[model samples]
Target chain A: MTRIRIPPTLREEVGGAREVPAEGETVRELLDDLMAQFPSLRRQLVEDDEIAPFVNVYVEGEDVRTREGLDTEVRPGSTVILLPAMAGG
Target chain B: MVSYRDLLAQAKAEIDEVDAVRAKDLIESGDPVIVDVREQDEWDEGHIGGAVHVPRGHLESRIEAAAPDRTRPVLIYCAVGNRSAFAAKTLLELGYVEPVSLAGGFTDWKRNGFPVELSAGLDARKRARYSRHLLIPEVGEQGQLKLLDSKILLIGAGGLGSPASLYLAAAGVGRLGIVDADVVDESNLQRQIVHSTERLGEPKVDSARRTIEALNPDVEVVAYKERLTSENVDRILADGWDVIVDGADNFPTRYLVNDASVWHDIPVVHGSIYRFEGQVTVFKPGEGPCYRCLFPSPPPPELAPSCAEGGVLGVLPGIIGSLQASEALKLALGIGEPLIGRLMLFDALNAEFSDVSIRRDPECPVCGEHPTITEYIDYVEFCAGTREPA
Candidate 1:
């Protein structure tokens, strides 16, 4: 089991919980499991099978893109965070 | 000038980049101080909450004040990672410990749904009182509310405090705390306009409270009628003021105020006057010169005369304190430059105003990168050290 931290803006779609637990061996599988549980998060995070440019995924404090994108391995109990670009003062 | 490509390459080679996960871990573990090296405008739009703002252009100058410890872990980031790379390299070169650039800046941090903060809006009555300020696009409703929420501390009730308190109260500063241990004397009426003849013999803080209350009820004035010594300076200033106005008359209190303000990282609006001359500057810790940066040591008492000893023109405080008030307002509203890194001099005799550029001293005792005096010192003794046979 891995934990995904949801941001404030997306909390409503995740039953208003800040963190949700899912199961997977890789970032792609973990995200797939997360989307299966909360279908609304899929479109917000994925665009045509690639993580949207606006959405960033971090696996255990490392950006998955800098590693191997969705192929980055995630050990059980690893923490993943999803973030979208925020341009504010 | 070096080409951008070469500069970026050189900076990149000298620094290490941390992936977003490592940066997050550092933050979660509370082991690193996060710095946003973006322009002010970019910062106001959105930034990682709790990240200190030390823009890339001024990183070297301000980093010491923002993070005084050379051994603290620092996570530096910009819009992307490029500017932060240079910032990280500079921090390392300056002896900062464990400096790293966030691999992906706020852009990616946000895109991935990371937490970002937006400035909240203003309320209605405030919108009406500061409508004139709101007319200016820069200080519209958003800036007005910031002003209403700002806490300003004034160190004296004489001279400079007169005009500074009056105008700041009128400008709608939310909270103004005044510290004055003296009672209003007949001589104070010469320049301390905030205290009238009828208020003579009353504590200056009480006198000032009456004046501010009459001018604007919107402002709340907290009066501390005790002199600020090393013992109480820290406790009094601990409440967290947005800005501090150094209106103290003596060198000891001035140095005490400067040291405390530097230690707390609060910007101080410094003003002083002689018979026909006065000077004003915004002494921002680390970002610009603290008082000690300009005057490394206080002058010997024989040479340093207070306004009480050397007669001052009655209107001197009005001119100087008004300028202090303007600077405080600008600082609170976050609109216009706040006179940081520059000292403005006014000579009433010649009716001339001059500008002196002030640079932060990398070696300043109080705010230097390797600061020796992190805690408040016995300022009286420290200033007196300058008087010894030198």
Candidate 2:
């Protein structure tokens, strides 16, 4: 269980609340619970059992998708940030 | 007495010319002509669809005929608007009513995110209806919805189709289909400004399809490179197309398009531009004056002009074709009063567009009570044009 910080772009849907607490033993657990709640973020975040390309989800300013297969253990109050890479012409 | 757009020099001083956004605004205001003064190459890349291209490099030579009235107010634009400013000032000096310069050059226009057209061959009409649409409250959003939900079929990739096609694409029409069997030609570069030399030898449909795709993916383009003859006209018309805009230059195919639209219960947004004059009308057979109601019969085959004979003024279609696009958009949007019973006559020579209402003919064939065109039949004789096979 830890606190997850939503990005500014997506803060509106989460009740304008910058941070929220969730119960999850691992990254996978946390993401599953988040997706179950928001639903729309699943397509943008997950694909083929891994984080989708262009997406960067960080735990305490650290990239987690690269280090572990969503099994990164979380402390009781760790903050997560979801960000997607930007591209332009 | 003359426009600076066709200047012989590289752009002497900077003056704002009419870019597409301001041009569209003036067009929406219900008056003013959009005149482009870019070189042929620049125009081919992309110019305002309905803008008359006089080429800044050739201003003095064409202004007299392009804007015959020394007193007519015109908005001008060039690559950066400098040449056009020169042209506009010269026009003012010449006693033309008024010549307003676009705030920036076409490049500045693109940078500012304004609409410009890029259809090759004949650009179909792209003008939006100027009157009364904005006055209606019930139609605002609902009409835009209808336009987004509708699919219009455009015949030909030449002058008439170019403007029409570009406007429909920009106006956010849900789906648009371009049907043509020819490829791009250098001579067509003069008036058929949509296709670039880079796309030379490419099928007209493929060229138009790619242009639409690059410009806006939201508007799905279903291109048919095959000739739209009577044989397959029915099948193509049956695709639940909301409206059919006929730009076919020849008689047989034009009639074929008309008959198909009538049978399919789809409206026909009709447009045709000759040397200096053009005709525009909307047809749904039973609901309004059919194409037959206006022309009844095709002009003699020998007299019809292909790109070769009736050299279209590079910007002539830009005016009429865009109107066709506007009419099609209005029909789809259901926001404004459709040109259903109206005929628009435009004269670029005088830079004037006049409108007249047309009445349905009860004695007509297809849409008339006792009809002659029932089953899908051949129209080979009508499709005959003396020009090279297109």
Candidate 3:
């Protein structure tokens, strides 16, 4: 079971659960499984099959986008935390 | 003497409380008389527009005059929820039928981007002087008044402070306090534009004040002709400032400003410059990671050369200082998303701006959950320890 932790901004669109469990073998599969349950989150997280530029997904502490994007390996007990870029002063 | 927690707990048990959302709803729906019980300076920075002003100490004596009707819904708030809880209990005991405490208080209200109004005080002349600012929809009458009522403490009057203070003063920041111990040097002419050729030997604070006052007579500049040592950091910040602008060039003063500002719950607009690079961020205590959270400790002395040693581009401070001024104004207005958890890196040579996401370290020495540094530490000694390169 891979745990997908949602940030506060996207919580409302996904039933407000801070953490949701999904079964997948990779980062892409985990996101697909989680978004399948909550379709509303798909639009916010993904745009035309690519992760939104603002959203960053970290698998086991390393940013997956920097490593392998959606193809990053995942397994049971792996934690994926989503953080959005905050462009500010 | 009774503990503050005991009093707050007792008050909580005795009064009804409303969250910031519910409090806003109450204000929108009916004629609830909102009263802010924070200190006078905090109230001046920004308050829930139309909220009655009754400092917690005087609430019992002045509540009736501010909101006399016992039947009316009286909502009260302090810095956080604690003081307001006690104020609510006092209001309930004063025979008010529907007295409610704002659960998270003014800080929460401000963080939510709710409307805040300054008390009516800016004269027509001052308003006309700020006509250009008022023209912008984001910085209209309310924002201009907010600018006029805000107090920003610039930790240095050189380099970064030069442009930041100039713009802040021109923007009609109600009170601008400048802290700098050094005298303007001939070398400062290259970057510290706040001082002129004639004012070379004058104190930086004095020189900066003269420049700012000349720029805008409406601004009141308080000159602290002294260094920001650990001894005076708390004392200088004790009066409570809306925002703290870190313009210091040294590691010790920079860290001192961070710790003091964080302890006081005042957001710090931080900026730093090297030879051709600069960075800007807002170290909002409890809101995001502080300077300590970002650097943990100063870079080894040799690695972190002074501006004199590592010659900055003359215009670099102008760019980063302008950003600091912008951040301070945003904080004062309680509008726009500040760089609370983001560090903006600037490369002058390449003219590139990149942002790095910075999160608060839960184990951070100063701002962590179980923190070790409660008060200001010996930052000078801490930074002076020359260590071997790892």
Report the lDDT tens digits of candidate 1 across residue range B1-390: 899999989988889898777677788886788899988668778887778777788787777867888898999999889889989999999999789998778887887787887635344566577778866646655567677788999988888888999999988899999998888888778778888999988988998999999988889999988978889998889988999988877767777888989888899998877666677889988678887766655544433444554467889889989999999989888768889987676768669786656667787788888877766655443223221100
Q: Can you tell me which runs of candidate 3 are displaced by over 4 Å?
A: A1-89, B1-121, B381-390
Clashes of each: 20, 48, 0
Better of 1 and 2 by lDDT: 1
Docking class of 1: incorrect
Q: Can you give the DockQ of every candidate in the order shown?
A: 0.01, 0.00, 0.02
Q: State the lDDT of candidate 3 residue by residue for B33-129, as single tens digits.
A: 8888987668768789887667788788767767868999988998889989988888787889999999988889888888988657446687679
Candidate 2, A1-89: lDDT as tens digits: 67776643344457666566677988889988887877766765676787664355666555564447488877777767665321000
* TM-score of each prediction: 0.55, 0.51, 0.59
Give the 10-residue window scoring lowest on summed lDDT in candidate 1 chain B: B381-390
TM-score, chain B only, every model?
0.66, 0.62, 0.69
- Candidate 3, residue B297: how far the Cα is off, in Å: 1.5
* Sliding window of 10 residues with minimal summed lDDT for model 1 chain A: A80-89
Off by over 4 Å in 2: A1-89, B1-142, B303-307, B380-390
Q: Place model 2 in a CAPRI quality band.
A: incorrect
Candidate 1 lDDT by residue in tens digits, A1-89: 98897743356679977689999999999999999999988767776798765455777655576578889999988768775421100
Q: Per-residue CA lDDT of candidate 2, range B207-256, in tens?
A: 88788777766688988888887678877777778878777766667667
Residue B35, model 2, lDDT: 76
